[model samples]
Target: MAVIPATWDMYDLIQGVLQAPWYHMVFEVALVLLIVKIYISQSFSPEKTVLTDKEKETLVEEWVPEPLAPDVPDDHPILKSMEKYCIEGQNGKYVTVNGKSCINLASFNFLSMVGKKEIEDEALKALKVYGVGSCGPRGFYGTMDVHLHLEDDLAKFMNCEEAILYSYGFATIASAIPAYSKRGDIIYADENVGFAVQKGLTASRSHIRWFRHNDMEHLESLLIEQEKLDKKNPKKAKVTRRFIVVEGLYLNSGDICPLPKLVELKWKYKVRIFLEEAMSFGVLGQTGRGVTEHFEISPDHIDLIAASLETAIASTGGFCCGKKFIIDHQRLSGLGYCFSASQPPMLASAALQALKMLESKPRILVDLRENCERFHQKLMNMPGVKVIGDPISPIKHLMLAEPAGDPGLDVRTLEMVVDNAMNDGVALTVSRYLEPEEHLPKDPSIRLSVNCELTHEEIDRSADIISQSFQAVLGKLTTRSLDVSSPLNSVQQDNRSLKASR
Candidate 1:
């Protein structure tokens, strides 16, 4: 051992020790071990905070929130008393409800193809081949051959250049409208347009000017006003696209749109026409081509036509047919088509089969028309009940001669009448608003969906039952009014007298 002088200091001593063979290796190993120990301690450190039982309970009580109640009252008498009728079998001309068979005047199976064996067979075959669902949106590898075939068939049937499919019937028009119309655009829509169109209009963020239902004059007046406004602001008007949206057949009123007049106005106002034919397709026209064929106008005259397969096609989806350019735009822009899972192959195949059947057997349409006419004629003869809609339309509305002074009472009376009809083995429905916020028909009515499968006997029986039910309900209401000594008793008495006269 060398004795270190005071002046030689710690530096010289450290140099001497580092020069030893074991010193450097031992120091390096110890340093590495110390670093490893520090890393292990920090990396595995616990993050959770430990608390006593009392602390935990206080924390939980502080974090918990009070239960919230709904803003709207949930205990309305009508709502509480209403029974939801569930069908156990196919909703065709007749359905099984709660294990009892009832004639289905409520379903929209206008062509009676919903439970057809042939359509079911096609659907079954497709299901076996393609499984239950498409599992992805149309743009994301979800386009099946069946969907394409159905689109092509629809295009050919409508005599349009192209067609596009949507997964849901309601989404067809809802997505199509927003795809073309955006904020700052103007939409001149019928006040009686279905709820689907109203939703689309809302989503489009467009300026909506509602014209009276089937009132071309009001529409024209609105168009004239728009024209004047456009003339005043030529640049803004040039940029703003205007559209005239109408239903081929109005669902609310059960009336047909004047297509020729709408087309004339479209050209006159230089506005694009969007026809929602959900209720008319496969029910109208010589070949079931829809309102355009029914009116003997060119399909090309309308910019876009949207219809649902759920109605006469007896399927689950919907379609839009137009020029290739117009329909192609929806591929990217239509939210429902772009984002929703594609329509199942089975449903698409079913729709295709239904369309084929419609084409091969044109007699179905004729039968439907005849049934509608017969039913309309019978309903016309009924007292205190006014029939609404074209004679050829499958949809019919039977309204009261006079409202019961109170909307709630009117609804209650109509509901009672519907219940009476149901009890008599007829499955009739009241026309309730799909969107209550929108303007609806003045008087609530019972909506009867006539199908080709409905026999003349069935039609007559339904009308008779409906008339008797109407009288019974009115008579009961009149009796109640008499008991109350209300002014409405006089009106109810008059209605009873009219019923007796009939």
Candidate 2:
């Protein structure tokens, strides 16, 4: 081998390579073109391959899903078609539905503030200033001055140490629950709790034990059983946190939970209590402070109070208020509050204005309670109808005495009565349970939501229409039952006559 200098010139190596073979350059050019061609071909080709039938079948078997059914069955009672109404104005005691003015009993506008000029004006002003959305979560530059103000006002109104706002009403309790209670924690929930609470309980992934709705004794029994279990599993129980969740006023059953009893149980069992006051926040108590105020119980007793602004506040968010330590935890831990976009400034302003109206006009609460009582008293005597709920509750459930032998038919019949009431110039609604898999009332019922704006005559008229519709439906049902039994009765009578003759 010839010896080369340790540091050979780069030019000398290039000259040697250039002189070695012209085919090398030709080969390099061809290779480069080939690479470019392959790249271009792949880029232009479709992402997926056209497979043979057998290959396709194998792939489908591995990855494809079976055909999906409809989200709701066609024969589902709630799917049955009925007259749909579109409100053109404020959702108050009376609303213009589908171009016809109807007495409204279908809305949750308990304080009749949805379309109030003052609230709307405030919302409009905020809209002009803030445009629309906060554009990010509260933790990420999404906390507006209005949001902080509303939270402060809510805390003051509820007489709590602190309050935190959620961008949505459903997300409020759902986020709050899981924020504190995690896996291995135990939650004692009511069977009749609303879907929101159920979702929260599910998200928490906690050990959930359900008790009968509004049955304090049943709740106490569950607590006792849980205590015993904890005692048996002392090691695990020492680390496990226990919670009792209840609604201030249940949406499905339209009944008030015995909060005083729940507070008693809370102390007795040494468990935390979480109250979801979506419906009762502005409908209960003389000052509309909800179940705690109604029962004259200190707000400090409840571990956490979560409520929706969508209802009586006529807004689009929710809040959780309690001791500073409890609410402050959700700032970092609540998934919805930490990740979701903040509520629009307009909606928050509307809620704040609604709260002011509530404070200024306490008469609205009285009016709402009176309307609820009057409706309850009037409907209590109706044939084949049983009114279920507290007399002061704005929500009432009128149940059928005898179901039409099927859930769908029974719901349809009650819905028909609601339709009839609508036809008679009144807007009414049927209570639809959100969770069918969970324990529900045996029979579905019509839900009438009373608002403060409803007048005496309006209430009376609504009661009369509901009464007449129920009576008519009941008469037809009775007639059909009699006709069904007529043949059996006739056969029995013929047999009796023959026996006598013999």
Candidate 3:
């Protein structure tokens, strides 16, 4: 009864306040004004403009059509200098380029399994059964038993709960990132990560923080900063997922990441780690288990691992390995997996066979490591060049010791050296990148990929050819400066000139 009286008292108080004449009159006037506003809006909208046929034609004719992409000039540097060399057949320790058989230091056949009989037999069998293409995405009648078997094999080999396969190697990490990460999340990545990783980070739409290449102290500082930010907004931080993205072996730099330190930081900061092992998966570790195994760190500490099969497996497509729950989510959420056709069963079979071979013959990894070290040492002896990468890394970049200071000039010089090397029956490639798009653009250099089948004599010969090529090209490099309008004719010139047209 007392509660009822209090409620009545409140009601009476409100009534007394509303009893004033102005309050009622003001309420009525405001309601009337709102009604008038709505009426005015409904009664008065701008009329749509219409044009006659003649007028429309005139307008269309007056407007110039624009090109979808900018045009390249006849003298575009890359086009003018680029030479197309056709490869005759299979990739092995030696491959034929333009009908010339050369030491295959240019291909990514790290495990020397490209021409194996067992892998070819497996591929032939799959081709007989599944044909060339899957013809549909995984969800739409494209998944084959071979695909499932490969996934299972990969999961077991990587010691992960499950795995997901992507039709394209480039899209594996690119799609996996946006599948889990979104606008509000944050990704801390190495500045020197490959272009594929750069693409993934861009697609994720997450805030990215870049640390110096392979600098743990810089990474730790960024973590500390993020921790302090989380403290300020604990509620928001609870929902925001932080990830540290890095490559086990950098495709751009060819140096191995310090996995032990990254794992320690992952624990200290409570951030998940996503490791890309495209270049290291079958080229590192004692049995080619990759960087984690090389550093004796357990894969359980890492959240996800993505790698392309093209490198060591000598096949197409790629795969991501992680917990079952996470891998399963990509089936529905990953754009590449959901919309793109599944990988050809033949490639999967080839990759499976290759993986089996790697598991059985761990000696290949030993041979590959020895070859890499030998190549690295010999490359260092080459004049006018500096090797960038670890001794055990399958990939190495040979940069100019004294660059001409311009990337365009340096690229041309390196290309000249590559051409010379190719003529000498040693295939080589200049490291190429979309310079404008790189997070931290690397200088132009000759990128060399090591093959386990390369003999010590071949390694020495390749190194000698590279040195001779550099000495020849640099000797011819020249520059000239003259004052054509001078009252008294004068000229200045140097033997080294990258500014002059070739």
Q: State which candidate has the highest TM-score.
A: 3
Better of 2 and 3 by TM-score: 3
lDDT on C-alpha atoms for all candidate structures: 0.89, 0.87, 0.88
TM-score of each: 0.82, 0.82, 0.88
Candidate 3 overall Cα lDDT vs. reference? 0.88
User: Superposing every Cα of model 3 onto the true structure, what RMSD results?
Assistant: 5.3
Q: Which stretches of candidate 3 lie over 4 Å from their true place?
A: 1-36, 50-54, 75-83, 478-502
lDDT tens digits, residues 172-196, model 2?
9999999999999999999888888
Estimate candidate 1's alpha-carbon lDDT, on a 0 to 1 scale: 0.89
* lDDT, candidate 2, at 250: 88
C-alpha RMSD by candidate, in order? 14.3, 13.1, 5.3
Model 2 C-alpha RMSD vs. true structure (Å) is: 13.1
lDDT of 1 at 458: 88
Residue range 312-362, candidate 3, lDDT tens digits:
999999999989888999999989899999999999999999999999999
lDDT value, residue 477 of candidate 3: 64
